[model samples]
Target: MKRAAELELALAPRAEGVTLQRWLCGELRAAILAGRLAPGCRLPSTRDFARQQAISRGTVVAVYDQLIAEGYLSGATGSGTTVAAALPIAAAGTAQPRTSAAPGIARAAAADTAGTDDAATKRPRLSRQGQLLANSPFLSREGMVLGRPFSPNQPDLGAFPHALWQRLTHQQGRGLRPDDMGYGDGAGHQPLRRAIAEHLRYSQRIDCHAGQVMILSSAQQALDLCARLLLDPGDTALVEDPGYPGAARLFELGGARVQGVPVDRLGLCTDALPTAEEARLAYVTAAHQSPLGGTLPLERRLALLAWAEAGRRIIIEDDYDGEYRFDGAPLPALKSLDRHDRVIYLGTFSKLLFPALRLAYAVVPEWLAEPFASAISLTVRHAPILPQAVLAAFIGEGHFARHLRQMRRLYGERAACFQHECATQLDGLLTVLPITTGLDATALLPRGSDDRAVAAALGAWGVEARPISFYGMGQPAPPGLVMGFSACNEAAIRRGVATMAPVLESFNAAAAGNRGQAVAGV
Candidate 1:
């Protein structure tokens, strides 16, 4: 009796919007359905059941009476309530469970009911990582290859200069030395590194020699490599509270403890940085704080440098989308001002040249270059040679610079149109973030709204945008959308936002109704 009571207590649901009687009844039913509470298994007395569940005696009696009435169990004045003998049970040695099917079998059953064939039924289950990556909320509705819906972080595939890329590839390929096809330097192909160095100096005002540059697959990979080189298990790293999920996840996965420092208009609140004992690395997006679009003030930049110097902590500066500043002339990258070599500068070509390129580079300080080079050698050897050669040709031939200039002008015009449409159409319903330095656009909607549901509704309307909450580590995120406008033109931007407006209104109304219910409850 004591063992049965313990099992009942262990299986009980936590109190959440459910009466004790309702919870107990549901648990008992689930147990019976799952075959854990076998048919003919007798339930404890009402008083004992109530004691085990920490509920009133009347609640248990009510639950037992309900189950008995439902024909799931039987009871009498003296005999305890027992699972009914007629309840479904698996035949001995049968593959299927007696009552309900397992997930795989259930899915197969569902497919069969829908007339799917055996070939479809035998499909493998999606791995946890695969499922997570596939269902990432960042995916959009416009760019899916199979015409299903857009996947988030998808670049404007139509905009890629494939013809020019192929031409450049052929042009570079014709002159490739036999050794160029052989194992190259792990730091990167020299010409490509030199080209990146030159581009950074000319465009971003960051002066780094080719030796300091190391090519990696993407910004996330760069961060992961940095984490491996710099962090040890249980070491602390500071991250912006509402910052990049990729960086935060990588740091946590690398066995490093992460502290979420707050961010304001001027970027990461340096004053809020944990004490030296708490943190050894600070990851920042100073050129444009993601989702907020606020550039770190020059004063704060200097303060951060000083803090890093004093504490001997390293700064991983993710200069993602730094080239597309629409407001004013671009600010110098933090690496340009790092006389102490404490900054590991990361930049990506994904936003500019299309994400499919998978090209990004990190500028390591001279002292760390050798170890980083060795790390690269041990890991990915070097970036693919052909892309590097094509990029080098793109830079050397001046196409890259011209492309940046052209895109800047186009993005500026589209951004203006987007802002105008938001102001005109949304009016008081939405607030657009002021700065537009990056390839992305952000707008804050009213709090308490379901941004994910709103984003999904907009996707159904053929417009894709990411919910601002998707970027946050946890809840209470400000309601907003982090919209990528570079791939979309003015008309597309206006149409997308227009489509999104009704969804936003529906969310706002639902939120208001919820608030009303809460107030009435109070």
Candidate 2:
């Protein structure tokens, strides 16, 4: 009866494209690899298997014969149809335990009663990597959302020179050679790399040749590649507390143990870093820290450099929004101060040009250039070529620099206005954090406050805000909200907050009343 039940399960179909025989083979193979079937276990007789599955006896015989031939099953003189005890995959790998969590399982068991809604269905089973992506808190799920106040990771899309960009894209498309339209160099097009190298040298005071640059679709991609190449499963990686959640998720998915180091007004505390050569890589946003917006100070930067040099460790310096500094000339990038060649510096056009551009670059040590290129080749193979060409032209023609100059002045004004509004309207509830640079600033909430609920309320009222606690990976987090001022004008900021302050006030009053009632009962 158990054998019959197992046969029925193993032959049941999923998604209708493949032939029945092919699906049977796949199901059996996956069961073996996932360890649902143990080595030396006997499969049902071909006639019995056919009877249970309601398939042809010949079909069952062919599947068993194929499994025997491929070493998935055994047909030795004494063994009738036993699972192979020494399968090749089992020679090098072991099975996952049944106790593992099932994150994305299936819909059939619930189909009849639960209807067609996804939440009503059984969750599909996900692999270890897919499980991490499935549970990510930082990634936005909204598609085609209309722009609103205080959106996270937003840039001033309205200020972009759309007509000029369209013209440049059209111009580049016209000039593409037959070869240019095909898959490009995975390391990126030569002209764009050269353009980026020059742009970094002049703008961020970092030195690198075009050969040292690897272009990717986004900074998040760069983070994934570094995690894959530099660290192995269970390898330790140090990340900033309240760091970019996208990076934390990638590192975890890559099977790295990400340790969170606390960040202060200056930046990541170098003293808190591992003392005795432990972490394989450290990810930092030195130019403009993501949510908190603290530039790592010079002395701390020096200490971090020394720490990396001492352990021969690698540091990923994400300068995603480094260009729009309103304070005195921006501090020299961490890459500029590195004497040991251990820093991989990242920059993105998404914040500068626009997010839809999906272009970012990393300047790496000479030793990693070829290996990094090969990795990119094996993964995405190459970023789409036309956009790379257009951006190279845009930077070469001086339009990118001119745009930066304009955004710097504009964002500084918008940020000041945001601060003013938050102070006057939500002063007792939320305090605006220091804002020297970056596209957004944070508003710290009262201790123990629920920032996610507040952010949801703001969203319901047509404002898009991110809960500040979402960024921290481990340890207790202070309550706050990350507010993007670059994307919205002063009028929008004031108007949104005007509506927001009253809602927050009423929520606070109700919460106070509940606490008072509880105290009186006690």
Task: Give lDDT tens digits, candidate 1, residues 417-472.
Answer: 77788888887778888746766677888876677777777777876667777767
- Candidate 1 stretches with Cα past 4 Å from truth are 1-157, 474-476, 515-522
**TM-score of candidate 2 relative to the true fold:** 0.76
lDDT of 1: 0.76
For candidate 1, the clash count comes to 8
TM-score of each model, paired residue for residue: 0.72, 0.76
Model 2 weakest lDDT span, ten residues long? 97-106
Residues 308-400 of candidate 2 have per-residue lDDT tens digits of 988999999998888889886667899999888999998888888888889999999999999999999999999999999999999899998
lDDT for every model? 0.76, 0.81
| Model 1: residue 73 alpha-carbon error in angstroms | 53
